[model samples]
Target: MTDIIETYLEDFGPALSGTISEHLEKSLGISAAAARKRVSRASGNIRRLGYVTFARKARFMYLENQFGSPLYWRKLVDALFSTNSAYGYAIAALIQREGFVPEWEFPIVCGAPIKQSRHLSPATIMQRLKEAGLLQTIQVNGLGDCICIVQSEEHYNSLAADTRVRLITENILLLAVKDWLRKLGIVSFDKVTIRSSTHAPKVGTFVWDLTAPSYLGCLIKTGKDKKVKPGFVAADVYLGDTITEPGSRPFINKCKTLRALRNVGPCMQIFIANRYEKEAFSLLKQNGIMPATPESLFGEDVAKGLSELTSVLHDAASHSLDPERFERLFAALGKIEGAANQLRGTLFEYIAAEVARKNYSSLVRMNQIYKNQSGKKAEADVVIITDNISVRFIECKGYSPRGIIPDTEVRRWLQHNVPVIYKAVKVHPDWQNLDIKFEFWTTGILSDEAIAMIKTAQVSTKATRYSLGFKLNQDVYDLCKSTKDKGLITAFEKHYLPPY
Candidate 1:
């Protein structure tokens, strides 16, 4: 009976479970329940051999050997297109052309909000397609909700996490540039249109990071006759650590395409990043690409803020993430966008992780989320742990070099974050028989009250499972110097060290 069911299913690709069962019952003259049992058994066997299932209108077809197949996703998307051309094409264009589109903007891309009252609204169309498992929405940090195509759990997970982070990072840079442009009186926010991958036209075959059209010249405008200028402005941004030899050729090629497009009219081409190789820099200047850094473009303060935010975000992309915390981090990121000062604390966390890596010989993780048996959740900034040996949790405060650590901040770390983390560590099986250390590292002076609180907390925890310690600005600098890592030393001096 199972062999018969498998043979029947092999002939039909991706049929609903009920449809398969109904066919079995009618063809074999068996009861519905008996037929369903045989169908279930057959599917379970196929699933073990690289097949996958989905739930749409019902338990969707179990595809044979689709699980580990390189061509499976394309086949699945093609099937979706066969079912509904409009929604299918939208999904394909979003993934292939644009990469990903925020949900709100997606409707506009699809030529939505049709005028006639008789037809279904654009929102309704999207909602219906989502209900049918043709579309999926993943909430990105800072960027809000974004659209991707997937009908099953496996496919969703396969979409890389760094890809989403990269999208959010790019959008943040664009927003910053837009704000900077507005402040300079070059253009108002309303006049400027921030283009996305699919929304913006490609220059040759390259999709630019920034694309805008000019309404008037930078320094000239006729009051009586307002003539629209025929010109283009575009920028390409590199977010990698540094643009080196291997990566330089492709970038230069793309810049050449933009240069060729200049024949249509006057065009402004810009390149933005923190660091570039000497050769890459020369090539950019030779090709007429204006090379700009955050500091060069937006000044020292804004540049420092952008550098801190991107640094923390790059580190965050590697950790095992909790959905709630991920959302919070992104929300915090949005806040940091407006006020660069907000990134100091999060930025310090990454710096502290680097210090922990230099001092301790163990597995070090940042922004680790933990939950105890009673469902109490806690987060650790930097945790260094080796099974059955030791666990160190470090909380960081990234205030100004001469700033004072608040008494309330000290009180909470001792009173709240410490207790929760202790309980969380106790519940972990591998953390058994380990000595624990809890430390506060800050690039600021401690107030007298805050110092007393730390001393008291240390005395109280002396007999306990964990020990307590604190490192001020000078102490942190000394530890960093001990590491003898030139890059680490330079970063610490720039961000944390004080001038005498």
Candidate 2:
């Protein structure tokens, strides 16, 4: 595995070296020889272990498998800039700290301090940490950040007694449910929000509310002006696997927590691993609560995607030392990740092809970037032609986890370039007289404001005789799952979905 990854990195070494040298000269005023020496060491470390070994004696037996994959290693290397080994050492010390309490702040799991000086800035270091996936930024009432070191499911499950870790797990499950709901055509569904118990009791730990408006009864005196209420739905997710038996202190406390949540009108959900399912369910049932697996909440299609993702990860980790296995696993990862839109373009292409398979004969062309006679350049992510001579053009955007597709970007694309692109395609002699349709696809949640802008844009575009439509993260996932491909279904059942 190390050899395979080394070969992969060899293709990028010159680029990496150039980046490191420039950062060192600009950030630290380092000499060229010193920078080259540092780069050499970093490169050697990556080639040997696929990650930096910060601690001289500390062992990472549990994390060995994670280092097997080139992607994970690339993330680590990318996290460290030239002459920033101190930041790496600081992270290592934090990981080594005993009885670590997770916190949502810079220097999240503090142990040995990374000295603050003119040469090293916390802001830049923190940003690098986030880019490396060693940290994650989240929004609650305000922006907050937290450590995100566990790269795989196996590593996450190995942690003990960390409420924050448990919360992260629960949030992932909730996100899956939110995605599933979206796929089911619930466009009004809002993204789930995570709130700490310390902040607000009414909000619970996780909340999902729809934004559609509802009419309420009119005021008593006038009985004319009707009150308006916003649509809302909430769920309180409890990680209950740690409870050993019923009637115990922890079990009772959890029940009390659920009772409190019920008083606040949100449904209660408990997630337990299979090992503790019988006992956990018995205790919850006695309290009028039923425990649910992640699969049961999100359904089979989601389970399959989740399973395929993890299986690829686990396979890469388990075979990190074998070149043959590494190559095979790398190829598999590419296919899964490609279909999953790791490269951003694949997600759009996959959706376009799938839609064509269902309705059109086949995809005509993908990733067509063109300039009109007016010199306006516009790129369509995908293009397809149906048997009836209908032509479809798609634009795709892939956003990271917890990211939002903003209204401003969508507005610019819809108002400025889309019209010109339509004109350019219409002028093509071969495409003349063909009906044209436009679609926008994104793997991120679209804000209500953005959706409103899209709708308004759709109205204007329709006036020009072009049809326009949009699909967000949930829509894409639902469409893929509905295909019911046998291999995907098996992967989901065997790997992704929780064992019932």
Q: Write one digit per residue (lDDT tens) for candidate 2, span 29-87.
A: 87877755655545333532323333332111112334434444334433332333535
Q: What are the models' TM-scores?
A: 0.48, 0.31
Evaluated at residue 78, the lDDT of candidate 2 is 38
Go through the candidates in order and give each one's C-alpha lDDT: 0.59, 0.44
TM match of model 2 to true structure: 0.31
| 1-500: candidate 1 lDDT, tens digit per residue | 76666666566644456677899889999998897777766744353211222334334454555532324334444544444333433444454423355554554333222332333344665676567555667744323356765444444434444444445455666667766666665543465555563364333334456655544475233343565444555666655456543234334544554445433445666777777789868877887778778778767755655555555566544432122333344444444344333344555666677766777753787656565667554556778886667998888888769878888988988887888888888877788568988889999889988988889878877555889999998888888788776655666676567787
* Leading candidate by lDDT: 1
Q: In candidate 1, which residue pairs clash?
A: none
Q: Give the distance in Å from residue 436's predicted Cα in candidate 1 to where it truly belongs.
A: 0.9
Q: Which stretches of candidate 1 lie over 4 Å from their true place?
A: 1-59, 67-347, 386-388, 404-408
Instruction: Tell me the RMSD of model 2 versus the true structure.
Output: 18.8
